[model samples]
Target: MVLDAIYRGELLPCENNMEGNGRHKQAGKEIEQLLKDLRNNLSEEDMALVDQMLEQTLIICDTECSDAFQYGFSAGLLLMQEVQEILRKRVDTAAHGVF
Candidate 1:
């Protein structure tokens, strides 16, 4: 999946149209490992945040934009902010304990 994301230029060091084979396979393997580590270490709240972010991203990506591209970007930014808020709330709750 990470290899596909890299090949599609979704991941950083975005080499456009780079075929994922041979040496590039190593990079893909590394990315997969990193992702696994992230998943393993993530708290439940963090995982929830990731899930929300992905859901919003998918919704935005699927919708057709009649307005300028900036509108879509703005909407995505707002969704990201909401995800941040969720993370913040989780942190605050963890610190204070549930009332």
Candidate 2:
């Protein structure tokens, strides 16, 4: 999910170079770090899925021509939500021994 979000965030809708500078770059870097952390912690299978998602998302993001920042922000939030959901589910399952 983090990977997907990063890819989505990276892709821009415009040819403007400004869209890829400063704030957007910082956000992309942050997202990349989070994705790395997630990769380190998840199971191999999960990681593989995430990798695939990330690849697809990145392709989309690359071509996106408008609202790159907004898309990036949204992707970051979604990544956060995905991580939270994963952790919550893991904890809940561990506590209850059921899904």
For residue 82, model 2's alpha carbon misses the true position, in angstroms, by: 48
Q: Residues 1-99, candidate 2: write the lDDT tens digits.
A: 757856789643354566648998898899999899998899999999999998999888766634666788799999999999999999999999886
Query: Clashing pairs in model 2?
Result: 11-61, 11-62, 12-64, 12-65, 13-64, 13-65, 13-66, 14-65
* Model 2: CA > 4 A from native: 1-20, 66-99
What lDDT is obtained when candidate 1 is compared to the true structure? 0.74
| TM-score of each candidate structure, all chains considered together | 0.32, 0.43
Tens digits of per-residue lDDT for model 1 on 1-99? 988986997864324435656687897798678768878999989977877986897577546332445686689899999999999999999899873
Model 1 CA lDDT for position 40: 96
Clashing pairs in 1: none
What TM-score does candidate 2 reach?
A: 0.43
Model 2 residue 99 distance off true place after TM-score fit, in angstroms: 80
Question: What is the lDDT, from 0 to 100, of the residue 92 in candidate 2?
Answer: 92
In model 1, the worst 10-residue window by lDDT is 12-21
